[model samples]
Target: MQEINSIYPTDKKECYKLILAQLKSLLEDEPYVIPNLSNTSALLNGALTDINWVGFYLLHNNELLLGPFQGKTACVHIPIGKGVCGTAVQKDAIQLVKDVHEFPGHIACDSASRSEIVIPIHYNGQIVGVLDIDSPFIARFDSVDQEGLSELVNILEIACDWANVR
Candidate 1:
């Protein structure tokens, strides 16, 4: 296989670049739903750099259930307003935690995840799921990531335009 060049010379910027590109490809002609979840999880886990957890928690019936994922075993479910991913959906905003330990009501899905960025997936004016990424280093995420991932969600939102994200 051919090795790919880093989108950014530094690790952080490359992470966003790879994620954005792969998501664009994955959702290209692909509708957002159960069929795409598996590939999305794999693409997230494999394409991104330095991530300990790359997966999704789908919003269904007012609760979050563990969807396709790549990492250690994670929480099976989270209430709409609970934990990092859940709260993101509940609040309909992105949560970029510099340090999960310092954040109030943060759930330690994996002790190794010191930092996290969770973006709410919106559909038809409602939150339906979250794109959650985790890293083992504190302050691994920043505002740039928040903005980049938010754009990612928009792209995905359009791809899955017919599905109910919530």
Candidate 2:
């Protein structure tokens, strides 16, 4: 996997769109893992600003365990209703937190994360994981990001729904 630490002149929305397109191109059959897109964590971390961590925490055993990420070590376990990711799962919705500190029962996976966005990913009609993104700046993910990211993940779930593992 490649590691990207910075963003160039490429447009954020367009870049992410292209990225999603590329990920779609790599799709195979059901329950298949995204081999080339495995490193998306790094790309997202670099492309977006004020973000210290970018990745997912899969739902397993009724808990959210850390998955692939591009940042420092993070908390491995988070129960539903514990943190942003948990809340997203519990509500089956997307959470855009401006300040992690102000969020009740916030899990300090990374002390540097001030803002966060968690989008639930469903597989075979079941909540399987979340597309989590964090930022150091407050209110980093706005409506544009929320809508775009949500739509992007939706496309992923539809095309790659057969298998969104890893």
Estimate the TM-score of every prediction.
0.84, 0.82
* lDDT of candidate 2 over 8-117, digit per residue (tens): 33566776676566555555343343432355565566666667888878877889887777788888998988889999999999999988899998988778789999
**Which run of 10 residues does model 1 get worst, by summed lDDT?**
2-11
RMSD of 1: 2.6
Q: Cα deviation of 49 in candidate 1 (Å)?
A: 2.1
Clashing pairs in 2: 31-162, 31-163, 50-136, 51-135
RMSD of each: 2.6, 3.4
Residue 99 in candidate 2 has what lDDT?
87
Residue 70 in model 1: shift from native, Å?
Answer: 1.3
Over the stretch 1-166, how does candidate 1's per-residue lDDT look in tens digits?
6433343445656677777887788788877576576777676566656679988788777789888788999998898778888789877878988889988888888999999999887777877788899999988778777877777768777877545444
lDDT of each: 0.78, 0.74
